[model samples]
Target chain A: MTTAVRVAWLAAALSLTLLLCALSISIGSRSIAVLDVWGFLLRPEETAEAAVVTQLRVPRTLIAVVVGAALAVAGSLMQSLTRNPLADPGILGINAGASLAVVIAVAVTGIASIMFYMWFAFLGAAAAAVGVYLLGSGRRRTATPARLALAGVAITAALTALVQTIILTNQEAFNEFRFWTAGSLEGRGLEITGAAAPFVAAGLLLALLLAPALNALALGEQTGAALGVRVRRTRALTFLAVTLLCGAGTAAVGPIAFVGLGVPFLARAAVGPDQRWSVPLCLLLGPAMLLAADVAGRVVIAPQEVQAGIITALVGAPLFITIVRRRRIEAL
Target chain B: MTAAEMPTHQARLAARRLSVGYDSRKVLDGIAVEIPNNTFSVIVGPNACGKSTLVKALARVLRIQSGEVLLDGSPLSQYTPKEVARRLGMLPQAPHVPDGILVEDLVARGRYPHQGLFRQWSQEDADAVDTALRRARVEQLRDRLLTELSGGQRQRVWIAMALAQMTPLLLLDEPTTFLDISHQVEVLNLCRRLQREGTTVVAVLHDLNLAFRYADHVIVMRSGGIVAQGPPREVISAELIEKVFDLSCRIIEDPETGTPLVIPQNPDTAAKGS
Candidate 1:
């Protein structure tokens, strides 16, 4: 681990992400050539080959990259913020919160418009995060990481149960929710990507700025304060950033598991617990993972398709296991 | 000394009628103490006597229930945390080490108060970190991970981090508690050296003899109140130890340094009150 090697890894990962993005656009139900994909990317034409590239594959590829990066940032931030190596975006029920809101929207209006429900998902995620924070912050000023995690688990459980009951009773809601709960990128257009990307961008900015402070926080709460970090305010802002990230990701695609949980560990294993390095590395690694999974899913069963979320867990869990077996996990 | 050379100065670091507590229970109340400039000061007391509370309150780790702490002749509350951090550094009791963090990087974190988003890792920060590593005698372990270091080495690295803060005044809460006799002495010696190097050092120490041996100024406490303050030789006596700790002890001289040393009486002779 020299600086040169780390920089090389970053460059390689970025190149891999770009390669995967290109591959996702070309290798799909139609398997367009690289040259044709390039032409379609520059100026989508009237032909059917171009239609597959322009109308369908490109938007999903963009959504996959954006949501993947957002989840990765959210997961890394959540893990460090809670100081729980096991922590991820779903630990605080952001996914469950968004899922519950979307299901409620479907049951009420029977409309599946991305624009209509994305806002509800975002609000629900923020509300759940705020609720967990309120419950976790102790009677006084002490907000232990373990206490906060327990609060998250509790809220996530309650909201998930509510979502399950609502969807089970409403047949139409269940049919609509089933597609999303499977975590597909199919049929999601650029409008969904457009609605989600700004929040993710804002979150990524906040997370990068919060990086050095999170490094100090790895030392512990009292030590963080001793190092002149404003512990309470920093944690609050971290919550806000995580909310935006997880809310937007889960809103755009259904909760894409494994990328958020596994990629951060990969980032930390390559580097140490320095969030300055881990956070940025995660941004590159996350999308590379998701788009690769998305591309693989388009032909995993041939003519039939698996969702990107299913492929990620199927591929990611074993990859995670293999990685941990090779390299010991870093302590938070 | 010339009259102009030895001029009058106010105590830049002092607490006035300070009260601190968690929840409703008060740990320290109406306590006042001043750290002499460029000297090592130690606060010693029985368990639960609020010495740690006093140090933490001064460090601004604990919220003051009433009154105020002043640093550089201004109320500590007036300065932002980073501004206060520029002048004062503290090491909390048994501070945790981030897993897999390298010694140099850990020391570099002391630059937080000085760094902004744009001006990270300036030349001055690099020099400060190097100086800290050399001064704390951890330059040899600069590339070592905290998990690989021995307890004494880890403590020294932590001190290096505080030194890297490059503050004029340093506060440590129970710096020597978890160490063996030799490690305890090692940490205390480092603190004393920092004082000699012109950094004002304040620490809460549990070992009465060690505090007396190392501290130029001492504050003794009982039940959250300041019992005595001044040089350890004048402030600590057999009567004071008995009154404060309920232990019968005799004061003797350290042959090497001629500092006051406390020798407790045998249990057969002193175990009557309980």
Candidate 2:
């Protein structure tokens, strides 16, 4: 595509993302007017609508935006690092691993706090990342994308079953985990968003800085090294960033699936595989998608709501299948 | 045998008693070598004779266990990878091209070492990419998808990427592997042109005839040791070829390039002249 069209597309994506964020704040169950939302955003006041805006919608929007960026960035990083276009935190069992850890944390301590369970999320994500890599590897060589995706599916299935068994047996933990597993933004305040934002931010920063190295890595490891990219270091940093993003994202929202999987695919489809463009594109597209899911969830049933996770799955699974049918193996 | 010394020119990239290998296996054992500046050097050897290992070590792709690589009079370890990359480049044995990537897009990634996080896509980078495309004659193929290109075209695209790095030194490993003989000559010609343009080019080639026909300097290896190193005509003899390759052969001068050409002996006969 021409530069002008690409730039225009980029601008539209940003505007659309901002519009979604605004819509997320404005169109909750009660439906505040856009004028009122704008007014409240401009000037703080002691009003009930302001309270609804500040106390509820704003935090939900922030968490959606943060988690959206984190998951999408993590997914892009995984795809580039593994040379696997099909890679996603959810598909690769990272989210399942985090879910199991959070469940175990709650079952063990009866403490359902974000601060308390997020650490376990990181550990579980690390373990799953390593486990999938080992299992996915092809006969003494590095993992091919097909094998890695299969390994991811296997690991995801196993961990998800373990999560189910734990949640079913432990009633106390089930109460804490059910709302989370559905992946809703309801009843969560700024506290959880605050707890998760820094990690997401760090992961985003690392990803952005490592973008050029990732581009070099696209040309195999030895070539990347010859080009002065520290391959092992870049891979390690990417692993750390992916773990942080997935861990924090899973902890913030209970394993929200498909935002990571689909947004970056859309980003690459729009632009090319250049990480510098796609990664930033993911930041915009990711939130636009999740907030769309979240907003649609609010309006889908009006009073009673479906979870954002359910909506994304409804949308993302078809997209995933289309991608599978469209592309051959490990070409990226 | 020791390499012939040319005390006049200082070698920019040289190794010192380099000993490297996997555990319990020594691939290159205490081999010292110097690569002259602004010349086409080919490392030719039998299978597993450590030619690729030596080139990889000089390119700083593999870790050295017991020796040091010096680039431009400084130990390579002292310079950051990016710093070294500005002066050296390598086109690996089988480099992967990302599917659906345009040739220009793939070539542009060669600017990674020259680029920084905030300082991406400068005028210098664009100029380098253009120059590389022109130099490798792939400028016409700039918009084409890399995967859609022929094997020879893809090889030139990879060489274009290395050229885009704008390094003074370039190393290629079996760059003509999958290409036909004509394409092999095409790649070797490109390397020759690169050498003419004042870039030191080192290629690890399996084809001794092509290696000798094109290389201004040749490093011959046998069983992890440098058997000979000098101009190809002096270094590549029938005796040396037979000793290194265990193949009886006759060394004939190439009529086109006036370089040594190896013709294997007929095993059934013991004739001195054909």
What is the C-alpha local distance difference test score of each model? 0.86, 0.88
Candidate 2: misplaced stretches above 4 Å?
A: A1-3, A31-51, A130-151, B4-9, B267-274
Judging by TM-score against the true structure, name the best candidate. Answer: 1
- Looking at model 1 chain A, which ten-residue stretch has the lowest summed lDDT? A323-332
State which candidate has the highest DockQ. Answer: 2
lDDT of 1 by residue, A240-300 (tens): 8998998888888888888888889888778877788888899999899899888889988
By DockQ thresholds, what CAPRI class is model 1? medium
True contacts kept of 1: 0.72
Candidate 2, residues B1-274, lDDT tens digits: the string is 3543555238899988888887668999988898988899999989999988888889888888888888988888999999988999988897777767889999998998899866878899999999999999999999898888999999999999999999999999989888899999999999999899999999999988899999999998888889899899877898899899999989898999899999998866856443
Those runs of model 1 whose alpha carbons end farther than 4 Å from true positions after fitting are A318-331, B1-9, B271-274
